[model samples]
Target: MVDILRADARVGNKTYTSATVVIIGAGISGMCMAIDLIKRNNCHNFVILEKSSGVGGTWHDNKYPGCCCDVASILYSYSFEQYPKWSREYPGQEELLKYLIHVAEKYGLYKYIRFNSEAKEARWDEEEKKWRISVEVSGDKDSQFASSYILNSDFLASAVGQLNVPREPDIPGLKDFQGRMMHSARWDWTYNFENKRIAIIGNGATSAQIVPEVAKVASHLTVYQRTPNWVMPRLDTAVSPLQQALLTYVPPLRMRKRSLAMDFRESFYAAVSDAKSDFAQQIREWCVEGLRTQLANKPELWEKLTPNYSPGCKRLIISDDIYPALARENVDLETRRISRITETGIQIEGGTSQEYDLIVLATGFKTVEFMYPIQIYGSNGRPLSDIWKEGASAYHGVTVEDLPNFGMFYGPNTNLGHNSIILMIEAQSRYLNAILGEVLRARAKGKTLSVRPNPDALKRYNRELQEVLAKSSFADSNCSSWYKTEEGKITNNWSGTVVDYQRNLSQVRWSDYVVEGSAKGVVEPRKITHLGRVREESYMSNGSLILTAASVLAVVGGVLLRGSSLLRSR
Candidate 1:
């Protein structure tokens, strides 16, 4: 229940503002942390720095055609704030963005968010015992007050999750292209693709979602595939009015929907984690069935579209349209390696050049490079980039060894392969909220506090984590994924299931962190009871499974009674 907000200090031309907490992003992670700060910790003195003009993080940035989530809509959203009226089973980018905006407005977090403020550098001040963040503020053209300033905070929470920065391929002559070029993340909707030849550079998940829509409008579409991906059928269906009403009125129906998706994803862990398992083979068959069946007529493109590595090596793609789109007469699948880009188009390895009117780069993001382009210095002026020179590692992917009073959302090894990341984010939010609450308590008593993960704890945790990750399909030597570094270290995905991550972060282990100054040091471990809220609602008293079954029976019984009455009348 402590609030500290001041802007009294000024040195030369630079101004300094202080806050109890500073969250660097207005995405789901940052918003989740802000809401937790308000509800859990009762702390309101925080500022969220967002580089974009709006919220939604990745959803806000990537506004391409046919862009939608692979996960089920019911389970993809926040557990507490459920949306019963999703248009489709798999919601698109706009719907997701609307959900985020609605949540932010409901929580009244807009007052604390600085839309165009970007954190460039964050350095720990040993003397001041706080984090001094160098923030650069930029405004749109025709607007004034674009400047840079210094902000100090008692605790720094980096909610700038991965997938923010778009990665363009390092191909030669990329700049020499005279035609219109754009990355999938930065789509230009204004440009008309009708009756124009278009070339898509990558065939990953983003491209998988984009190809279908582009193929419809373009005169001719060429998809440049370096390596094919495992694609399963997306059972996307419209949520009818009846279903929406049931979800809205009967709360159990909504819980049941999420529970079903969660259970299925939980069972899907073996498919991604252990590629040799029966579940993995089953998944492979489903993917193969979808691919072969969709492109059955185009036998020539079968081998070209088949993956060389295992199904789960790279991120899995769930789409029913990508294959059929590629099978279109105007669409061509190019498996040949690209040599370089020409002024007009792309040149492949055999010196075969193809002209195109537009080029789309779907080369994804700099995922392994956690928090890149933002220099962060911790204890002893130790650079965080240098510390993670080999690979990024953190204790539970939240607290680092030397970075005291700092927590990261969706950090290294926290990304999920089989389940929704909202679960993980909530867990990390609760854990960080506990630490920040301790900081607030210290501040209430006129004291400064810093708490960082114990080096030994971090080391041990990562050692065990890497060991488990080594056994996963992501460690396959046959294929390279964005999950790994150039030196072959897995840094992006969690080694276990979402449930495992939740259990690991369910308790705040005080002994695992180093406390500084006047702070709550080691204490008996306390369980965050609310951490079990989601699972409890799914499996416990609500009895989502039983309710789901009873609801099905009720509908069946109603139909039978109606049928009997009709027969008697006849």
Candidate 2:
């Protein structure tokens, strides 16, 4: 392993200066990319610029009262490093955040991360074959160091993730609200909800989690439901001391347990993809039963909350105890549409006033707006905003046609409907590492290398994605979701299983790229040499002959040894 300090010293040199790869966000994706680049590819000329002071990205930011992962804790973690010691099946936000921090520390990713350093804009410089990035430090408010920081790197990986910015609804009199108001992503811990009248804005995953938690302590909790989601039972359980001890001692047992969890999660994708399947019907029935049992008295409320669209149209909310929380006397689920916000309360469409001391908007995130609040200009001096004006897209959700040597982790159409995102992240990082390997080989041979996806190929890939998405529950128009953009395009989700994505990116197509170098200098093709083939051939021809010769020599040697032993005894 190369010393990170030595690696930093080696950077900015004549040969290694051009090899630096800049990663925008220090989220799960960014950290995963860094791990792959350094440990696997041995490319230490990289820097991760994170706006936040710490890691965990979304997990770090959103720390609401009852914030937790909907996905099973085992499946949510990295496949390579399975954590068999989860406190619950569905781990809380703090636990998940700690896990991410552990992963970062274990990989020594902190040295590569520059906290509070935000990339304001990145422009591709065609003449220099590098990206001119303009970054700003948060504390430097004087604007004295406004000069662009030139990063002469061969590649740019935007792992900034899709869900950085929070999306607030356009209410008529939102600014007029006199009481304290804040988004769930930006939770205000200073404001005490104890004995205070609280009003939650949206009834999505975040709201579902927050309402149940704050309702226990709040004077009054009113949940404003825009559109009710299909909520399912979360069979969460605490990890027993016995199980924890077994995991610590028996490694194979933990591996088996993780595989079992993975298999169970992957089975859900079939139901998500095909709404007409038996598995899908079973899930729907369970959801219906849950609603019927919970809201037995208030059938009207149950009917209003029940979704008309398919199960996976929007994200499925997991809560075995959310309905019980709402059933409590202190909790109230308001299905009425908000007409406007008053000076000290909210006004319903039916001329009703619901006053609250505090209002929390669990309104989710602005997912469609990729890399928002930052300008990205590609080749030909065209802004990324203008390029993807219609909708954000990338070749294989990693590379774009015109954007040479630029890669995106968890980019458009890469979000999985099933399985762990860590699995996807590992696969993407490996693919990017392969591309970087090719770039380094080209550089070593004193050649210039540029790689981009073919426009036609990209078109076909995206067309197939759109087609699958249309058939899936995400395209269901009855419910409005963050998965769909303004124009009703599903740009944020993968329409298939995680295994399919892994297979697709298993190998990088070198022919899809363009290479430039000295006219006289011959360049080696970037391809994986099949050492397995040579090994197989050698085994087939020489194996039997070599074994026979060895057997005869062994017999002769044994006879000689026996004769020598008999002579010594006599």
Candidate 3:
């Protein structure tokens, strides 16, 4: 058997001196990537640069009223770190944020992260085979760092997701609205809505959540909806203490729990993928039943609220009792077109004016705008914006053409519709680790590493992705959604199941890349380090023993079957 200490020391020798990887975001994806790198790849020379002082990514950023996840709480977390202690099925923002922080702490990932540092630009240096990243500290006036502070690794991973930019509607006289106005992404808590007339723009997830919370105290709530969404009943429940204790004591039990959650989530993939099927019919019936029960008093409201487009075209809203909130006497759901905004309120298409004390624009994020505000220059000084001027295309939604030694997490078409993105992040980290492993091997042999996907491969992959998306629910044009760009291109979501993505990334195709380095090199001897070896050995030994016991039990079952047959013959 290979000496585990020597192997780890060898791996550490390749990773200790320089950062082999730099993850740009300290969100869930970034944190997962770091854990995978350290535990699986034995890589310690990576850094996570977060623009904010803390982690949690979107959960950390958006703290608007009634903000929570649309995805079920059970399926929203890392599969390996299942939290059975959730207070609600669709956990509130603060709870989700706390979960992320807990994960970071458990993994001891705080040391690998730098807060309040934003990546300005990343340029690939052809000669050095390293990325030249420009980062600026938020409060520093002139503190800038070139490539002077990076690990010696040749790979760059951008976990800075596409949905970070807040999208402001190009409404006429939006800036002139004298009443305090703010985007859902940048919620202003100081502007009190208590006993105030509030007009909320957009009936998406944010609007749905905010409406109920604001309606509780607001004098009157007016919801401006250009298109009505298909809101479904959310079967949310709090996790009991007994369940939490079981998860904490027996980690393997959580795997069984996650499997059940995944099974339910996978059913939605089929419903969304084939919108014309029976599943879609069932969803329509559910929506109609919900409408009939909630808007029974006003049949006219039901007709206006019914969606003409397919259920999957846009994001499906989840609510335990949103219809009841809308039916309240103080709540008003207007399906009118906005003509313009006045100083104190809004003017509708029929020239009707509605007054309000505050306006909240839950317009969603600028998802189509990938890596905005940051200018990226690849080899030959070619800008990424110029390359993807028409539309963005990436190899496995991680690597791009002409952008050597750079990998991105949650890149084009990698967003999921059915499962937690933590699965995708783990898969990507494995794929990236394979490539980096080869790079280190080549370096030890005195060769430089260069990995790029074939043009034909990337073209075919993206073509299939777009084709699948065209048939999916997000492509329905009856209602405009953030999923599509200005040109009507579906550039945000992954069109297939998480399993498909995982299987595709299971192995790296060497033929798809071009590696450069000296053919001959010498391995440097280094001091032995046994970090995490004892824990790793304990787990591995237990797993091996379990497999051995299972094999023996299977043999015993066969022998017992044979003896039963002999007894029956006698």
lDDT for each candidate structure: 0.86, 0.77, 0.76
Writing each residue's lDDT as its tens digit, candidate 1 over 1-570 gives 312242211111222277778999999999999999888877777888899899899999999999999999998888889999999999999999999999999998898888888899999998777999998988865136658878888899999898999999999999999999999999998999889999999999999999999999999999999888888888899999999998987777787778878888888889988978998889888887787899999988777777777667899998889999988999999988999999999999989999999999999999998998899999999999888988999999999868989999999999988888888899899888888887877776777778899899899999999999998899988889899998889999999988888888877777788788754542224422234424622464456456776887799899999999999999
Superior by lDDT: candidate 1 or candidate 3: 1
Q: Write the per-residue lDDT of candidate 2 for residues 1-570, one digit (tens) a residue.
A: 543223233354343224368888888899888887877667777778888889999898999999998887766877666677888878999999999999998988887776777888888777666677677776555234533345557678888887788988888899899999999999989988899999999988888888888989999999888787888898888888898777655554565566566667778887766778788788889998998898777676787788888878888888887888888888888887899999899999989998889989888777888878888887788888887888988877888767777888888888866667777777788787777666655555555566667677788889988998988878877877888886889998888877677777876665555544331133235443211100000122245544655676688789999999999999
User: Residue 559 CA error for candidate 3 (Å)?
Assistant: 28
TM-score, model 2 to reference: 0.87
TM-score of each: 0.92, 0.87, 0.85
Candidate 2 to native Cα RMSD, angstroms: 8.4
Candidate 1, number of clashes: 0
Candidate closest to the true structure, highest lDDT = 1
Expressed as tens digits, the lDDT of each residue in 1-570 for candidate 3 is 542222133324334334557788998878877887777777666778788889989998899998898776767887667788888768999999999999999998898887887878888888877777776666453245333243344677888887787888778888888988888888888877899999999988888888888989999999988888787887778878888776665554555556556667767877766678888888889988998898787776897788998887787788866777788889898887898999989999999999888999988887876777777888788899987887887888888887877788888888876666766777776777666665555654546666667678788888888998888887877767777786778887888887778777876665565445442122122211122111110223446555755676688789999999999999
What does the lDDT come to for candidate 1?
0.86
| lDDT assessment of candidate 2 | 0.77
